[model samples]
Target: MHEAKSQNISILSYLANRFDTPVMAHIAFVGINKSFLGHYVGAHEVMHDVMTKLNGTRRLGLPSRMIDRLILVFTVSCCWLAAWLDINVLSIVESFAGPAGAIILLLLPMYAVRRVPALAPYRGRISNVFVTVIGIFTVSAIFYGLLG
Candidate 1:
């Protein structure tokens, strides 16, 4: 993250935990040693929990698809947020006013994103099933487009 100079500490930790989990999961399936498994998975489970909570907000009746779109478009246009080069953290924060600002930037379009009936299925407070599909769609799309 220092390489990109991203000021979002939460995003930074998120990137780190995302990096570790796959390796740990793979290590487990491959029957890797216990010590190595413990080091990698334990290091990231806390963050897995945090990611789960942020995702839980959709369960509170908001999937905020536009925010997801903006995030995707941001990645496509500027390269992955994680791949941005030598970005100045302070300058970025100042440009948007940091996390409070970033979140506002993220959430400003909620009224619109949740309005479509196709997406209205996502309007349920119990979005575990709906958002799971949306989540799968987003990940497959972004992952294939960006990394596949």
Candidate 2:
């Protein structure tokens, strides 16, 4: 039991690192592990309960869904910041593509997601991607409008 828990923690840590966001990784781990550990620890008490127990105390925090949304927003903001900074790095793309191109880039992911049924199951991940694309485009447009 202890070994299994340790292994699960390791896996969660690995996933967290891979995602580059520990909170999101923890959310994923809780969501996925809730089902797997349900049988052993009662079906009614899963991730939330187990996490509380593991930590020895529960801390007040935003609900999981809210946290997920926040993560998406944060990711998008970061992407926007990156794109804004990239105007200095890739001036040529900004010069040629201009605001119109930026708008196209922003809307592209949303268009693809709506058109592609296969991406439905991964909506959360897709939303992150969409937001990122939108952020980049928005920043690019702003940069073009300001500089060009």
Candidate 3:
């Protein structure tokens, strides 16, 4: 919550500085409510997905409801600790965003197109090669920037 608020203010501050008008930033911030809600919804969905996958593994003897509660509590505690410790949010994002985005947005779609029967008809398109090349380049560039 604190991070989100600070991020919003920093964005608004950037807009104001860029435009040389606080009024414009305020106007833009009005439209930011949608983005703010989207972030929260995305986080919720990701957490739910994690819980679902962990429950499916059945490696733990715990009940599904108990596992979900435990995950929720753990997530909340981690968030609280990060906030209290003033961890650098951007560093955390930088560490995970590259690999996660590459896998989720790039690799998975390509895999589905190539291997899934329902998506088989879409395979062998020139766009697939183009997108794969672009995705690889983007991910490579991200890693290069992080490393160099």
Candidate 4:
């Protein structure tokens, strides 16, 4: 177990050196391990748990577990389709970066400060309001540019 963990760490470190950012490094490492389908599978697991909770008593006729499995199947199919279509993934990522950056760098921190009890002391600060406005503006600008 120790040797395996060390190997994983080395791989991640190598990816970190190769990629521009830690997020990119982690994404690269994950992709290297199992290709992009790894992300979809992880998403499926999380969504499965969430759907199971939201679908109490199997409201969809099928068992709740079956619904989760169907979601996984659909997602995997879409993943394969996207792969076969040779989609320009970099372009898709670039388009989303502006809005996603704003949300991650600005909005999420402000949200945490406002909602998290541990951050209650910093709540309602002017900085939070300013940051949130900027974040919203950034997102809006990105969307507007995309649409118009």
Candidate 5:
């Protein structure tokens, strides 16, 4: 039991570190409440809570949740601004890294989350949201590419 628990913690920590940049960059550039941002943020928070609980520490405060929601709102507003400026944020990422890269950008973190045993209970919800977000982004990107 102890060994399994430790392994889970290590995996979660690895995933959290790996996912940190992409999550931040996505929110910073592409905005949130769209794509997989909400799901990703939720997964991250859940992982954090799990880690804290495992360590026998307090769960994160409500303030953290509020901040996350606020960031989502801010990102959605920024998306509107980007549209006004004729900037296709997804396209920009695709331009630099290609379609596969964009898809991988979204999938990598999700794959990491799926690997954590601690998250097994929430796997169904996580995967459903993940697939939905990926589908939405894929269709939009393809349409945007074809039209643009």
Candidate 6:
């Protein structure tokens, strides 16, 4: 439980180490909601597609094919977000953490998900928490790589 919370704040603390509170907050917002990124000409439609695919995955209980889709999109999305933020945010994260961090961040969700003991029956709640953290770390890794 505690490690999860720590991971939750890890990005914030990491940002605090590098920037003032406001800019950190701005980056946090961008990394999370991603609506701000949608201000770009086509970002909105792309977001809709991602969201739809994600929702369907959840609704279908994350079949293997969907999981693969999620993994691929998650990786490519991290690269794209990292590249975009690098250009828009002065390249702080990219220079600081680079592709390695971005890739690790993108893989965090899979890490958390796979941590579950398969011998035991599935627990949706716990799985959700870990996966959520993974999502946060993955995108933060991108932004962090781009603007850290």
Q: lDDT: which candidate is best? A: 4
> What residue pairs are clashing in model 5?
none
* Count of clashes in candidate 3: 0
Tens digits of per-residue lDDT for model 3 on 33-135? 5765677567767877777677678565566677567756876787789778888766667678887898689867988899899998999999999888888
Sliding window of 10 residues with minimal summed lDDT for model 6: 1-10
TM-score of every model?
Answer: 0.18, 0.23, 0.52, 0.62, 0.26, 0.21
Per-model CA lDDT versus the true structure: 0.49, 0.59, 0.74, 0.76, 0.58, 0.56
lDDT for residue 33 in candidate 3, whole number 0-100: 58
lDDT per residue (tens digit) for residues 99-130 in model 4: 88888999999989978899999987788889
Clashes of each: 0, 0, 0, 0, 0, 10
Preferred candidate (lDDT higher): 1 or 4: 4
- Rank by lDDT, descending? 4, 3, 2, 5, 6, 1
Clashing pairs in 6: 92-147, 92-148, 93-145, 93-146, 93-147, 93-148, 94-145, 94-146, 105-138, 109-134
Worst 10 residues of 2 by lDDT: 1-10
What lDDT score is found at residue 71 in candidate 1? 45
> Which TM-score value belongs to model 2?
0.23
**Which segments of candidate 3 are over 4 A away from where they belong?**
1-65, 94-106
Error of 2 at 33 (Å): 62
User: What local lDDT score does residue 113 receive in model 2, on the 0 to 100 scale?
Assistant: 63
Quote the positional error of residue 64 for candidate 6 in Å: 0.7
Better model by lDDT: candidate 2 vs candidate 5: 2
Instruction: Tell me which of candidates 1 and 3 scores higher on TM-score.
Output: 3
Q: Candidate 6 regions off by >4 Å?
A: 1-60, 87-148
